[model samples]
Target: MKINKLLILAALPMIGLTANAQDKGPQKNDFTVAATVSYNNTVMQNAAVGTLPSYNGFQAQSTNWNDKSLQVGIEGGWFFLDEWKLVLGGGMSITKHPGYSGVPGSADSDESFEWGDVPSYGAVADQNFVQFNVYTGVDRYFKTKVDGLYLYAGARVGYAYGRNISFTDDEYNMGKSVGEAFNVRGALTGGVEYYITDGLFVGAQVDPFAYTYNRSLIKPQEGLSNLDANSHNYSILAAPTIKIGFKF
Candidate 1:
């Protein structure tokens, strides 16, 4: 009977310690607000068509690198259940392409074709792209040995608005237009964060896959007709992001 009593006493302290740990665990009511930046370097292929001879009846592909764009955004989330959160975010991005210029019939004519009979004829073409996106997602956190370290996995859906402007210096004035588009995409993500204090943290995240549906309107150039196009794209490998945030 004495040994049984000692065993019971030992178990009581362990039970108390477990209860104390639970009482000190992270709260479900915590709210977090964060800022994020991301870069993607993968090249994407885009299709183009137009009523002009240069564009008519020809199947052509344009290539652009996703990493050439820069993104900045803000996100906010509330933990409604232990280790589970619902988040909403918005961001903007800018992308650019630099084109080459060369003179025709001169020593500088190596890169560009001569237009008409002008000996000094030269051409330079470039594009600027802009985009804005809004998204929402749910994440579940996994606890780590470090008190403030967190790891999570989530899925997100977003709507985006985009525009592209192409500029060219040529006698025929080709490759100038304002193209606008809208798209929706879904992504799967994983992230890790480290809290610098009880209320401040820094993190990083990556999206492995993102599928998009897009619709675009290409404005008429000079005398050309307006072109409307729809496309579906899959980003098998998306972007990785850096994030910082505060919790309350």
Candidate 2:
């Protein structure tokens, strides 16, 4: 009798839980939290490459900062219609762009590269970048399921903030300096998710966007007054990103 009562008491709580779960209907959410990793490639170039007074490639400074990066951000929104989700999200990507110390021309500047593996223009100075991005997008979830899988596609537009590369030559005490630039870009993404539990899901997302910047200051000649400082065009701004995050 004692064992029977204990089992009955234990089962009573589970029964109540099941009943409660059934009574709550479907889950309705107006907000969501997202954390993601983004792989970006930044490229900028002179709009008038060979036609202008500036260096052919000197439209703006370029960095691999948006290269392969990681991002963490949050999103919240309302579900206006059951078949469509209006989602908004923002995030910051922190990355370690490989610094070039040897190769000049395409790799870096000819400012301060003195003692390195490749050659010497000045003292070997490193070049890199870091950035933060804010994004907003809307996705349409398909109303079909094979084994509880939902497909979605959306577009994102936002701003990116980062610091340009700067270095000085110890030989002539000349330092390279560039101003910070905030640029705008857009992304198109699509993904599929399978719910393993009530609030736990796993999925994949991809974004292809462009990253750009302005041309910074570079000392072309060594202490020559009659000579002019030549500005080079930046590289291209285009990258495809793959992402994985969560919803809470």
Candidate 3:
């Protein structure tokens, strides 16, 4: 069911591609609105478990860990001048481990295991992670001389919040805390868009460079106060983005 939903979302940009081509793309005073979708799969390596509980079960003999997510976003832009646009947008992402069982050698097994298979597999509930962000930016399009094609570049600043909540047990006896993070980020983005018609187009973009400041908080146990962690990071962030939209 989930895979089907993701497949549908991924195919959105292809819907209007067969429309009649427009003689020109966006011009001054034109407005653009778009929806973006993205997916990410990240492989995680071993990490130090400093000062944390050394519980066994799922954590024992860990072999692999992966983080996966699907995101949806919307944006609106105003062509304030020829070849220049002012944009504002926001997005939300949901992360889940549909097939991963935090145990060694079980991640790729075709056999499905139930919670009863492992007595200490309380961590199975650690499947949901969610994030949201909003941003404002400017974009520039360089004429390519080729009809229906344009090169794009942009810069944006955004604020984001994310949380991962899990349980020590399925019941409320050992309530879990939310692992939460707040981030302020900036990025330089570039892409290409081709107008299928005067008002419709599809494009792909990437954040080749980005900077972020993050503050994370988590509680060790049900009744405990949160512990704080802060960090500054710079990297090429995010997966390739797919966008579909209309300009008028």
Candidate 4:
């Protein structure tokens, strides 16, 4: 079921690529399908867990929070009504930050594991998300040329779906309150996009914040007092992109 949903999101861009070509008309009504490439450094983002326990009996804390990460994706759109375009697209992203060394065994939690799988396995005590975006929004253009660059801005909303979060046995018992997954997540996103050309764009977007709803989450863990003490959040992000596209 999860794989199918992901496939649907990943294949959305093709709808625009198959549209019939519009002759001259307003040109804005033309559709576009461009392969895009983008890279961004997540220099800073802050999260706060509820509060940490004075006891050192358990292994707890969110993974490295300030580490840098990278994202690359492809996006395309269909302009059905000249000025209004429905953008349905998706891409993949990876985090550069490696997680804690291993799932140290303990009396309360007996889970054990190797350290190398931290990032890829996502099976340890770490907080990270991996997913893509398929958004739809209205774009209004005001400029001089059909293919030339134009400045524009608009609202976008989409559904975010992924298994992006998981847990290892060693990560159990450390929940702010109780019954929190190694990671828990759901998708929600909104942001803006700009056109450098009818087929190219530069955009910045963010997913809605994730909520653990655990009391302990409201309470800080050792390394992540900022999380519960403040808030531990992960998001589905698609941004700081320089993607070139084309109309079919």
Q: Evaluate all candidate structures by whole-model CA lDDT and list the values in order.
A: 0.68, 0.47, 0.66, 0.40
lDDT of 2 by residue, 135-192 (tens): 6667777644353467777776665566545454444433444334455555566766
Per-residue lDDT of 116 in model 4: 44
> What are the candidates' C-alpha RMSDs?
8.5, 10.4, 15.5, 16.8
Q: How much is 17 displaced in model 2, in angstroms?
A: 12
lDDT of 1 by residue, 1-248 (tens): 99999999999999987666444323599999988887522222222212233544422111122624765667899999889999997767788988656465643454554555346544655777787778899998988886678899999887767777776655555656666777677888888988776678899988777776766666546566656666666675567789998888
For candidate 3, the per-residue lDDT at 204 reads 92
Residue 113's lDDT within candidate 2 is 43
Error of 2 at 160 (Å): 0.9
Q: Write the per-residue lDDT of candidate 3 for residues 170-224, one digit (tens) a residue.
A: 3422345456667677889898998877899899988788776767666556666
How far does residue 151 in candidate 1 sit from its true spot (Å)?
Answer: 1.1
- Residue-level lDDT for 245 in candidate 3: 96
Ranking by TM-score: 1, 3, 2, 4
TM-score of each: 0.58, 0.48, 0.57, 0.38
Model 4 clashing-pair count: 20
